[model samples]
Target: MPLSEHEQRMLDQIEQALYAEDPKFANTVRQTNPAVHYKRSIVQASVGFVVGISLLMGGMILQQVIVGVIGFIVMLACLLWGLNAWRRVAVGGEAAAQSQTKGAEPKQRRRQQRPGMMNRFEERWRRRQEGDDR
Candidate 1:
């Protein structure tokens, strides 16, 4: 939904305040979000690696060794890029998930919640059986 006139004015005022107070921060926020860009770079590099490998294989099949070598270089670059991004994401993902689940961990540790989690699977199964019976 579009903002009402009052909300629009408030938003405009906020934007003005942000720019006036810290134009650099406003511009930085407007540019790119690093996490989003990192994720995208990882995806792009992965796809590029696969495509490059395929091209390399195709060139080899045509007996174009030089072209295949060039393709290998491009694929290696992609692999390095993807690997770096994946490492960053893996480390960050672990920390992020741990933070989100911090409180839940105490409950899990106290109750041996792995079994309870499994009971949830059983509950789902029971519901499915009931659904099937109906």
Candidate 2:
């Protein structure tokens, strides 16, 4: 449901107050993007993976079992980390695309566009708010 006029006004007032109290913090929060963070993580993980490869090779050449084991562990960890970040980016990109497409639809159509689980949860919430126990 859309916010009531009073609620909207109050929210606007709160936002203005926050900006006035600390414009720098507010700006930083507003400009921060999760995708950028994910991309950076991916780059870091890739570099770590390369380092692991070198360590593994060096350990092999030096005839050190411990170093080779440690390098293998590092490579495995970095591979998992990079894969996780990539997965998050893909999921987030899908959500962003869905939201953008949703904005183009009519309001009535938008209401019908909610996923089944979300619709059920909203319905239950509405029932509880209206004093219906079942």
Candidate 3:
């Protein structure tokens, strides 16, 4: 549902007050991009994965089983972390594209119409289990 004119004005006033109270903080919040954060996470994970590979190789060269196991664990953790960040970025990008295409539609309305991430994942899992390639 669209906001009433009075509600919109009130929201605008509140936002203005927030900016007035702390321009720097408000600007920082406005400039922050979640996608950038996710991308940074991915880069960090990639670096950690490389470190893990080096550790694994070093362990093998030094004949240390414990070091090798630790390296494998680190590799697995970084891989999972990177994949999670990638999925978040993909989902967020898709939502942004959809919102742009939708023009001025209320975000609440769009959210209600769209399936949640978990629902989409569950649906995909079901399809895979059923051998539906599509």
Candidate with maximal lDDT: 3
Instruction: Give RMSD (Å) of candidate 2 vs. truth.
Output: 13.9
Candidate 2, lDDT over the whole model: 0.89
User: Between which residue pairs do clashes occur in model 3?
Assistant: none
Query: How close is each model in CA RMSD to the real structure?
Result: 12.6, 13.9, 10.8
Q: Rate the local accuracy (lDDT) of all candidates.
A: 0.84, 0.89, 0.91
> Model 2 over residues 1-134: C-alpha lDDT tens digits?
57999999999999899999999998998899898999999999999999999889989999999999899989999999999999878768667777867876786676787657778999999999999978
Better of 1 and 3 by TM-score: 3
Candidate 1 ranges beyond 4 A from true positions: 1-18, 21-33, 93-134
lDDT of 1 by residue, 5-82 (tens): 999999999999999999999998988656676799899998999888987998889999987988899899999999
Q: Give the TM-score of candidate 1.
A: 0.48
TM-score, each model? Answer: 0.48, 0.60, 0.60
Candidate 3, lDDT over the whole model: 0.91
